[model samples]
Target: MIPALRQDRGQAFPIYVVMVAGLLFLAFAFFAVGQASATRNGAQGAADSAALAAAQRAREELGLRFPGVLTAPGGLDDIFKDEGFVAAARDEAVSFGAKNHADLLPGGWQPHPGRTGQFEFTVTVQTQYTVGRSVIPGTEQDHAKASATAVIELRCGLPPGSGGDNAPAPPPVTITCDGQDVPVDPLPKLEKIFTVKLVD
Candidate 1:
């Protein structure tokens, strides 16, 4: 009887060891998954912020370049065609992506082509982060990518012949800067003529 019990004890010990090993493996897997998720979220956030920064800078540029037009009684059809305006916006997007520890993909900063009235910019960014310190073989480092779009809309309400000195006083013009609708009071001083936002 004693001999039989010793053999059973040896078998049970191996089973216990196997169970502990399996549990440890599962724990490591869960940890890796959680870490990857966090990294992805971070990458997404960076993309959003970068896109927004780019759009905001572009909005500012528009305000500065078309200060008189924005406040005057006119439409924004011609201003969108300015090449310098688009270039400035793209440069800002790249700079913002770099600041967020992400790199903008080549030709990733794209302005919507068909849509002329509203300004829309899209940016794609990539970021790499470590999921584990060489513990998960090929998963030691992972790459995360995200894309975001921002829009700038102009809103103005001017009375007919409002530009003339004899014309009645013009109502305050409002520009949709992202989500905020800011009023542009007085002339030659455009305020919030454009807005920035993340579309995706």
Candidate 2:
């Protein structure tokens, strides 16, 4: 009877080992699922933040000069280049776990001038995901995209229609160093002229 009992115990050891292995597998699967969920949440937060930053930058650029302010005399392209809007958007998106390629993020914009006393700035950022192992070997990794639009207040030292009411205005002040009316240029350090404000 003692020898038979020992044989039974030895056979049961294999079954116990298999059961433990199965339990370990299940725990690992649960951990993976939790990790994937956390990753997605974090990635989504990053996307929203990046989009907002880009849009804000675009809005600031649009409002600068803007035909009313004499601080910076130029067009929208100057502000776009000076503010580095695209680069900022790409940097923000890349900072949030987008590391598939060095140039992983691509950003673009479309200007929609507001007709109702506001300015619109639309920014779009696209990047490839970098979550580990979630993208299976045979399938392509997920793509992340974010977009945002910002409204800017166009105000200067004067209010709207300050020059006149439904009438043509006179010529603006022009600086002259020699014979001709030399255009006044803003300082190079003057990059962003729009101030950020929070309204209730």
Candidate 3:
């Protein structure tokens, strides 16, 4: 009876060892998954930064040009439908992406408008770093990629007689932005009138 009991105990010891080894591997795999998730979140953050930065730069440019557009015939239409700045703003996006440790992909502009003077920029990026070695296959060489769209919307209400599209906005017009009046004379307060942000 003593010999039989000892033999049973020896068999159970190997079973316990196997169970512990499997649990350790599973824990390691979970850790690897956590690492990959963190990397993906970082990539998304970079994409958002790149796209928002580009939109803000374009807003600044628009601010500098707004009052002048009020005088030029068809300028408001051009301003509202402008796709020129998106291409010009690519350098800005690239700089921003680099700051966030990512690189911008080509063809960042989405030309369709939400309304007059609304533009969307679609930015795609790839992380500069890999997910690192993990139990997951190919993650050691994998780079997480993400895309974000930033929208540029005109916040101030266009004054009456602006004729919607293709008509020049007259000078001495006061536009309402966030319930405050901004005069077009002596430079329009465009920062309040133009808002740039990231869309989901």
Q: What's the TM for model 3?
A: 0.86
When 1 and 2 are scored with lDDT, the better candidate is 1
Give candidate 2's root-mean-square deviation (CA, Å).
9.4
Candidate 1 residue runs with Cα over 4 Å from true position: 1-3, 70-74, 113-116, 128-136, 161-192
Steric overlap count per candidate:
4, 0, 0
lDDT of 3 by residue, 1-200 (tens): 99999999999999999999999999989999998998899889998988888888878777767776665666455675556666666778889888989887665444356666687777889899989998888899988888998888887655556635555545646766667777766555556778888888
RMSD of each: 4.9, 9.4, 2.5
| Top-scoring candidate (lDDT) | 3
Query: Relative to the true structure, how large is the alpha-carbon lDDT of every model?
Result: 0.67, 0.44, 0.76
Name the regions of candidate 2 deviating beyond 4 angstroms: 66-129, 134-165, 168-200
Q: Across residues 1-56, which tens digit of lDDT does each residue of candidate 1 receive?
A: 99999999998999999999999998987887887787777778777887787677
TM-score computed on alpha carbons, candidate 2: 0.46
